[model samples]
Target: MDVSWEESVADSINTIYLLFSAYLVFVMQLGFAMLCAGSVRAKNAMNIMLTNVVDAVVGSISYYVFGFAFAFGEGSNSNPFIGTYFFALKDIPNSTYDYSFFLYQWAFAIAVAGITSGSIAERTQFSAYLIFSFFLTGFVYPIVAHWVWSSSGWLSPSSSDMLFGSGAIDFAGSGVVHLVGGIAGLWGALIEGPRAGRFDAFGKPVPMRGHNATLVVLGTFLLWFGWFGFNPGSFDKILVPYTTTSDQGNWTAIGRTAVTTTLAGSTAGLVTLFGRRLLVGHWDALDVCNGLLGGFVAITSGCSVVEPWAAIICGFVSAWVLIGLNITALKLKFDDPLEATQLHGGCGAWGLIFTGLFAKEEFVIQAYDSGESGVSRPYGLFMGGGWALVGAQVIEVLAIVGWVSATMGPLFYALHKLKILRISVDEEMAGLDISSHGGYAYTSHAEESQPRFYADYARLQDQS
Candidate 1:
């Protein structure tokens, strides 16, 4: 083949990799759907599943129209708060693989938007939630993306400020995606208030167990499998700058990331199982699943940069955080049906901070210098690096928390004022499947107790 032919082949390989990675990430929606469906009561199964579907549909549209622009756009007018180009995925060359890149990002966008659905699953009105999903993808997620992932982002170590440690080294968006989704979900749930009977008059929590352990475990396994794409496929490019990297640069990153990601999830699940047994005297399958998922979230930021041992530490601590935060949310009167706060928000923060403590100097250097990111974090504490990266991580966490809470609180409250933030108490008691969507997930006599689920979703729509 000619040199030109060789170049085309290489380009095609990268393009194919990117597209396949997007597909893997896209499948995470199914994981979210099954997980949510199983974690909720039987009456809300269909609702949760539909909400997951809607997140991909509405969230993708909004991200294409607005989110991609705010996230990746840049020009003379671009600023740290947002990107000023790529609106509607416009003005980008198709041959540049922009479409494939956009697709991958769109999938990520929907995943983040979907996080809120679980926390507010049983109680949120479908209309209000669709609206929230739309804005969340179009605005909330992209804003954080601009700040965290954009090369020109002020928080990017690649930026010229030299102000903070390595401009908050999140190789894969623990903050922009996971933390953002988690906090937004938390705020939305808090505003909507706890589920009926979730907290008694004396402020004690009541048990509202999920109906299907099988589905929950299945979903967790699916998420774990898809996470191979989530972490390893996070690389924006399969090639690196020849001036800064050796021939095996991309290959090494991929291998290390996959290993670390796997170790963290596996370790966390084991730790959580033991912890739950010690604390509650039983080996809870559900807690183990959540711990595994939390471990994945916790290791995402540092997956490509941390050593395998650090992954174990991140996962081990993350398991405890998952349990502790899940309980704390209850004490705070937040009725999160799936513990979104702990899995995404709390674990994501730990991932970011732990990265600061455990990320290796060479790996961080290789990552920053490898691609167009121009990002370079200082050495982590364990590597004899100072406190700069940790400090930046803390600041970034607090800032994101404030940003999401401030924005989401008002938006949900407005929906509440408009009387759409939640389903009617009557409808909630009846179950959203029957009252809102009008169908039961199952066909057995269990449908008898599910009158609302048995209702005609098409004709009995509750738009008002």
Candidate 2:
């Protein structure tokens, strides 16, 4: 097809914007690392950090090799369950736009892989974590991506079996990335079991607070910052090339998505704070942090489709979900230190549902019509009438949860039966930094040797 110079310029500009957006998404890896690092006990700090680093490394290599193919290859011609083309990405064009799109999606893939680390923190063997990261990124994530995001996906409105409405709408990845990651995380936590001392002989859960509140707060802020890129960038909203009359609506979705994301996160944080104080008689920083994230996850699916007011409602409800799930995780005794099972998995499911209940018909028209595919998506019942879209969402979320758990559960079970998943009792007590990596993260004033170091420091200060 012949193209005008203006269209060529637009594509080039969009490519650049996408590349930059991917870089912003890439920084989220650091956020996940720090957040998970701070959420674990002092002994497992380095271990969690290592798991994140390896996730990027392994995730990148594996996803590059075949993951993208399974997710995006063959595009419209792709199979329903998975893509059959682009093995080793051989079919992707050499153009700047294609590569930028590839890189952006790759960043999302890594974040999904990293989410599970927090749930299985502390007791997870580094080898097991590395292996799971490889399979999850190279195989599991890509398959799910194909199921929902790819044009041929059955859950897509464009699919032949869009059983409900345009299949299902996950503006970003509430179901594709977060929910899938959460279910996988929960499965690993359940199979790996709780950390030593996490439960007593009476099976009562014990409190195990993280060693660094500062890091947790910092991590939360960083995640929030990167989320700007995570949500708005999905639509490739660049101001320069997007000035044309036709592109204005795309720009609006981008702007509104960003606005919704910010409002959702802020409202979720405040709601979580109030809930914490009301329930625990004190405001808890970590709960607030998780609440903020839960809100983001919840609004992600409908960021472009839902109004800001709806975003606030989702955020508020997300905070409630986060708090409830955290308590439930403890009650279930899964030993999930990060409450990610609820934050991402539970809230991600809610994010999709939020889209079904509140997505505006006009906004959905703007987003779906302006989308690169030029597809007319199914609308929510509240906006267009009928329960098709919302019901599809419920089915989609359950299917994703069931698929991830069923796949990851057996893999973890095999690893468990082989005794390669969890660490030994001695290693659990000694901390993963020293046990797995053969060293302490801090040696000068060793955290594990705090009593001895503090006593000596007091004596020296007295002499001074």
Best by lDDT: 1
Candidate 1's displacement at residue 113, Å, is 1.4
Query: For all the candidates, what are their Cα RMSDs to the real structure?
Result: 3.1, 5.4
Please provide, for model 1 over 1-464, each residue's C-alpha lDDT reduced to its tens digit, 9 standing for 90 to 100: 45587667767877888888889888889899889999999878888899999999999789988898888887555898777755656566564688888888898899997788887889999998789999999988888888878777777756767447477888777887899999988888878888988988999999998989999999998888888888888876675443454455576688889999999999999999999899889889998999999999999989988999989999999999998997787788778889997799999999999988998877877677663345545768887889988887887898899889888889988998998888877678767877776566876725576443444343345534
Q: Write the per-residue lDDT of candidate 2 for residues 1-464, one digit (tens) a residue.
A: 89899888877778877888899889888888889888988878888998999999999998988798888888554688878655646766655667787899899999988898888899988889889999999989988888887777778755666766556888789989999899999899988889999989888888899988888888888888888889999886464422225546566678789999999989999999999999989979988899999999999998988889989999999999888888887777777888888899999999999888888866776665544344456676776646877988888898898889888999999999999999877677767776677555767527657775455445444644
Worst 10 residues of 1 by lDDT: 451-460
Model 2's alpha-carbon lDDT is: 0.83
Query: Clashes in each model (backbone N, CA, C under 3 Å)?
Result: 2, 4
For model 1 the local lDDT of residue 37 reads 90
Stretches > 4 Å off in candidate 1: 1-3, 94-96, 160-165, 241-246, 371-377, 450-464
Backbone clashes, candidate 1: 2
- List candidate 2 stretches off by more than 4 Å: 1-3, 75-77, 158-161, 237-247, 371-377, 445-464
